[model samples]
Target: MSDVHGRSSGTGRLVTVLAWALLLIGLWLWGRGVTGVPENPARPGTGDVAGLGTATVPLPPAAEPLGAAPPQRIDIPELGVQAPVMARGLDSRGAVDPPPFNRPDVVGWYGYGTAPGAAGAALMVGHVDTESRPAVFYKLSTLKPGETVRVVRADGRVAHFTIDDIRVLARDDFDAQQAYGPREPGRAELRLITCGGSFDRASRSYTANVVVSAYLTGTGP
Candidate 1:
């Protein structure tokens, strides 16, 4: 399939093949207790204990107004993704749980963490593909730096964010902070994450993760 740019490029083909391979591997891993899969690690809560006996530091306060409800929907015009957001938490391994294959159209928000439009970085994860087809965030990498991501909140407000950066981190070197860190201190931010880059048939997993970082730039009704 062609990318959002309508370019029949080789990269697009690789992405397609890798997507299917990734989903297959992911399903296989899920059945086997998620062992040996290149899964992204769970992000720690901001300013929380690093380990045992560590001094506690306070996290930055939310920048949004009081009572900004949880995100109900996410819309990315450039990628043509409009999906309901479901709250997801950590799995047995403490890694963020992704949406199940049965609901490929849904997105998973790290509900235990800051809500989108709240202070700090709000994380949302989605599958790059399903068993036989591309899923909600299949074209996530096609998003450009200047694009906008709109999140409709349960409260009647829409949080508008401007894409600041995008990174593809190899699973071997994935850093939780880079994926979950607030781009600017005390500012509300969002991170859209999915698997991308090369797929490893031997390991049965994708080699990298695509993390899109955006910061709150405006708001709407």
Candidate 2:
């Protein structure tokens, strides 16, 4: 089953995610000119923030793939984020597994692709907010470009990424090319995605998706 985006879709499975991504544009029109409401207000989280590359800083170059990975975990003390390991590969449904958004306990694996440290954008999608809780990505938008975001891969290696840019792009703008673009050799990049901009009550969605692009840096998990 291919998605409306011309990607694979198990209908029930990938459709919901594609809907959230695409419908965000409709939500934007509905909430025109509106910013996000304080749905789950908390202390402002911190990480490196870059604004379209104006304040650029040097980053560690991409390295060789670590090949097979050893067991590891991803932890973010700032947001109290901790999650177990899950390998993301193209599933039968053809859609990726979305990261756990509302709750911080579970982590999302990039459902449609490889386990990030492998090659392309280690795409990780988390819930900006679920019905019951403030998901792991509740504060993702707060991250600025050039800010450092780290990931501990299963292979006992840590890959650090310095954010390059943060964009509030419509679902229409999500291209597999950009969304899952190639990374530097041995360097692992990542993209954290979730609903952003404005949320709609009627459809229960957001106006846009916040995509944070980061370049690779650092060592083991």
Candidate 3:
């Protein structure tokens, strides 16, 4: 698969193809390239975690209070994503990190700014390519608008979101105000990000980013 997971978040040039694509997609995919992908070397709850609205610029407004999202699976059939809910937070770059694939028994979170299901645009990102093999989110860029995305909570409650749109962008095009900025008090939005565009070997990064936006539907059985 492709190893182009996670963007540079303005690191230093996006490893040629790394930062290139996700800037617009909000730190799109990540790396490594292998099957049975290495069980996240990251111990659960080990990363210097930041609860929603912690370190992000200006700090987004508080998230809608949740009754503790029960542990469960978040699945987006269209993209073939099915991972246990764990906390995903910002990678070294301040951009949100997605849960690693293939281990959704618990819940892996990308714990950075906003909670995954909170108000505004809560995001969950993942990988699409690796130098060796394709990752869970490899095809995440291909999801069509209106496709159904599902997140099952520990309480057996499932929240369904229907995609509103999918677009590609450049790193410079990334704007937190629009991306992470809050929406109406009760408004809920979801975004899934990944790498895309042509790979520029000289730069070692992709030319653009792939983004998916969705709106909450409701929890179901």
All models: lDDT?
0.65, 0.51, 0.49
Candidate 3 residue lDDT tens string, 1-221: 01122234655333433432333243422320101123222222111112111122332222233333533567888545676666664455435555544432333444433344544456565555545455555566566655677877655667677666666655544554455343445555677655555554445555555556776656567
| Global Cα lDDT for candidate 3 | 0.49
- Candidate maximizing TM-score: 1
Which one wins by TM-score: 1 or 2?
Answer: 1
List residue ranges in candidate 1 displaced over 4 A: 1-67
Better of 1 and 2 by lDDT: 1
Per-model root-mean-square deviation over C-alphas:
16.4, 8.1, 13.5
List residue ranges in candidate 3 displaced over 4 A.
1-71, 98-108, 182-185
Put down candidate 2 lDDT per residue, 149-180, tens digits, no spaces: 66776556776666776666654345444444
17-100 per-residue lDDT for model 1 (tens digits): 564344334433332323322333332111111121211343223335324367899999877878999988666655568888
Q: Give each model a TM-score.
A: 0.71, 0.63, 0.61
Please list the residue runs of candidate 2 whose C-alpha ends up more than 4 Å from where it truly belongs after superposition: 1-55, 68-72, 77-80, 88-94, 99-104, 183-187
Which of candidates 2 and 3 reaches a greater lDDT?
2
- Which residue pairs show collisions in model 1? none
Error of 2 at 116 (Å): 3.2
Q: Sort every candidate by lDDT, greatest first.
A: 1, 2, 3
